[model samples]
Target: MNLEILTPERKLYNGEVYGVQLPGVDGLFEVLEKHAPMVSALKAGKLKVLKDKSMSDTTSYAIQGGFVEVFHNKVTVLVEGAVPAEAGR
Candidate 1:
């Protein structure tokens, strides 16, 4: 699946990913390749990107809050603010 994480100031990531773990308002949820179309609200937390099936190659970000839309094998995340998790250390 293709994933894009965007903020008002910039685009954080844009590329193909195996799956992604999001901080849904209700809790954590994951979107994978060929997922059903839907939209959801997100909370302030970590967003994990699964770069591949092995889950070894991955990345994470700390997002303030946002909305996510899944459609046609694409995942779009619009957040108020975000930064790579490691950057926060």
Candidate 2:
């Protein structure tokens, strides 16, 4: 699926991804290829980017609240701000 992470100041990431783990207001949820269409509220937490199914090329960011929309094999994340997570392992 194609994913784009955007903030008011700039775009963080824009490319193809295997999936993404989002910090939903209720908890955490994941969006994958061919996933159903929907939108959700996000909270301050880590956004995990799965670069591939092997989970070998993963990246993470700390986001300060946002909203996510999924449609047509694309995921768009609009957040207040985001920074690369130094503690990603």
Candidate 3:
């Protein structure tokens, strides 16, 4: 799936990804290739990106809060703020 993570100041990430784990307001949820269309609220937490099906290649970010929309094999995340997990640490 194609994923884009955006903030008010900049675009954090934009690329193809195997899947993504989001910090939904209710808890955590994942979106994968060909996922059904939907939107959800997000909370402050880690957002993980699965670079491949193996799950070995991955990246993570700490997001403040946001909203996510999935449609047509694309995932768009609009957040208030975010930092790479490693950078945050």
Highest TM-score, which number?
A: 2
Compare candidates 2 and 3 on TM-score and give the better one.
Answer: 2
lDDT of 1 by residue, 1-89 (tens): 99999999999999999999999999999999999999999999999999999988889999999899999999999999998899332
lDDT by residue (1-89, candidate 2, tens digit) is 99999999999999999999999999999999999999999999999999999989899999999999999999999999999998644
Write the residue-wise lDDT of candidate 3 on 1-89 in tens digits. 89999999999999999999999999999999999999999999999999999988899999999899999999999999998898333
TM-score of 3: 0.96
- Worst ten-residue run, lDDT, model 1? 80-89
Output the number of the lDDT-best candidate.
2
Q: How many clashes (backbone N, Cα, C below 3 Å) per candidate?
A: 0, 0, 0
Error of 3 at 80 (Å): 0.2
Which has the higher lDDT value, candidate number 1 or candidate number 2?
A: 2
Q: Whose TM-score is higher: candidate 1's or candidate 2's?
A: 2
**Cα-based lDDT at residue 47, candidate 2:** 97
Residue 67 deviation, candidate 2, in Å? 0.1
Candidates' C-alpha lDDT: 0.95, 0.96, 0.96
- RMSD vs true structure, all candidates: 1.8, 0.9, 1.7
Model 2 misplaced regions, further than 4 Å: none
- Candidate 1 lDDT: 0.95
Runs off by more than 4 Å, candidate 1: 87-89
TM-score of each: 0.95, 0.97, 0.96
